[model samples]
Target: MLRFIRLIIYAIFSFAPLASAAQDAQLRRLDTIDDNRGWEAVGRLDVDGRGFCTGALIAPNLVLTAAHCLFDTDSKARIDHEKIEFLAGWRNGRATAYRWIKRAVVHPEYVYDGEVGAERVRNDVALLELHHPIRNTTVRPFDTNTRPREGAAVGVVSYARGRSDAPSLQEICHVMARQQGALVMSCDVDFGSSGAPIFSFVGGEPQIVSVVSAKATVNGQQVALGTQLEVPLEILRAELAAGNGYGSTAAGRVVAGSARRADGAKFIKP
Candidate 1:
């Protein structure tokens, strides 16, 4: 009788893993941005036409994204500011607003070569100043807010590898954990989704609370990682205002870390 009970317990645990995987597979892609007017503010940051990362307009001329997006993966050097462009409401080969980047500022504490960790991810946020402000009625910038508590409901709008031409909106994801300035969420994100905005609709309209930095597998489930934007964003804004946060092409610059996809999980950046 005891032996029979053990066998049943093992069988039940085996099915638990399958259930988790099913949940992650439910993320859907937003094929059209017609009804997603608010999502128009979220756009793709094309890096020298070589690669892309997701970014969102926080101010008229200021865009927020991941710091790693500013570095070249091969050269490990800072890409020139003139090489980047912001495509607001990009979908199906069309964009609502296209603007060139004039300047950019990464978190002062962010180290491009540092290993992925709580501190590194926490400081992975970046701010880009557009050469000209996006002044269109359809392409309004989003507002930033304080980080949400653990277990809070959130959403993410991004452009990823397979769905590169169009952006996707995951309207329902939850913050699984919040520790050391990083948020672990159940949101579905993949390559090219880096720097995507994580929003909370607590009061009414969606407000950006975090920015996607990496995607990882926690336990038997896949999850997305994000940087809490409250403090780091303020610091970056100040640094840019002081003209001290611009990238340099000096030698020995650290390259951005590549995405880790060995354990059925991948970092969502180039």
Candidate 2:
């Protein structure tokens, strides 16, 4: 939605006025990951031997993440199979379960910008197909029904800076504003936290309502912008209907010529 977008524009101008380095450090300290519980972690995918980004399982056999976080733009932006892995319920060097990637599916409208770009950051969500279906007990689709109020309490779970075992939790700001496709939250996140899920209670259920989209400052506070889950949920339903699953016959392949940039590609046409 445009709510986060407006915050970004507000940040660009409102935050230029200076503060102290101590304050900056304090702000960064606020960036914490919540306790590892109900949430589980997937792992990092990289090129050659270098680290890339992190992903998390959001369903029985599907891993959800940020499109740009996992895709390489320098060389055609394809989902590199050799680089993907999933470590569910990962904690303290141990994994409750593991799986290899069967296929990767980036959003059809996703666009990656080398730098922060308002519209480009709006379609940052993506999904991956696992070779074998994970049991529903270990991982499951996050409920998509919850909606947060203008000012609400939320938390984030993420594998930051390529660290596999050190997941973190931090208090997050409520919805600053809601845009057509984006919602702004007061949460501290960096480059590696893209695609991380934003959770809040809706109807007494902990559900994911947004995907981390961009890093921005709002009202002099740093927050990760998120794309609302509404449209992405629609896309996921269509995928399920089309039979893209561990046992489905969808083939996990987008039609040869159907690949198109998603709604907010940094360089591609939306």
Instruction: For candidate 1, write residues 150-252 as lDDT tens digits.
Output: 7778889998887777788888788877777877788889888999999998778989999988776655465777888899988988898798765443332
Q: Model 2, stretches more than 4 Å misplaced?
A: 1-35, 41-49, 114-117, 136-141, 162-164, 243-270
> Per-residue lDDT tens digits of candidate 2, residues 1-270?
346445555644343332221211112221223444456544333322233345666677777777766655556466455345565655554555666667666666665644344445556777777777778464555665445654566656655553434445553546666554666666656655666777776565567777776666555566667777777757865765676532433333333454222121121111
Which residue window of length 10 is worst by lDDT in model 1?
A: 258-267
Point to the candidate with the largest TM-score: 1
Question: What would the TM-score be for candidate 2 when compared with the true structure?
Answer: 0.69
* Cα lDDT over the full model 2: 0.56
